[model samples]
Target: MTNPTSPRRHLPTSPFRTAAPPPAKRFAVGDRVSHDEFGLGRAISVEGDGTIAVLVDFGSRQERITAPFAKLFLL
Candidate 1:
């Protein structure tokens, strides 16, 4: 039995809890990248010391993805 007033603890293997956010992804100009929804692209411009946003050219369009990019990955 557990104390009703006690704060619940997160299990080490708990899938519902996130121990830590994934590391921030960094990109540089001319880098190749793939996006979950945008397909393959090439980095055109980077801003804010590579911590703010990255401008990428996806051939058909360009996107400005902000920091902590979840769907963007370097190739």
Candidate 2:
């Protein structure tokens, strides 16, 4: 018999793991990009420094979004 409140056990495995189907790379500063939900816009800035950032466009009045470089596809 086991204690009902006992902590669950987990199998030992490699701590370091690689991401599957690595994210796509697109949209650099000065590059044009279009979002399915945000419509067309240009890459204003990238956040996370090494990850992604919120694209800004003054003409369309679109909001900024934090999207990963891999998830963003170049136009």
Q: Among these predicted structures, which one has the highest lDDT?
A: 1
lDDT of 1 by residue, 1-75 (tens): 889999678888988965675666778999999999999999999998677899999999999999788889999
Q: Per-residue CA lDDT of candidate 2, range 1-75, in tens? A: 999999655446857554466654644566677666666677676666525565657365855566554344457
In order, the Cα lDDT scores of the candidates are 0.89, 0.59
TM-score of predicted structure 1 = 0.69
For model 2 the TM-score comes to 0.49
True-vs-predicted CA distance for residue 1, candidate 2, Å: 29
For candidate 1, the lDDT comes to: 0.89
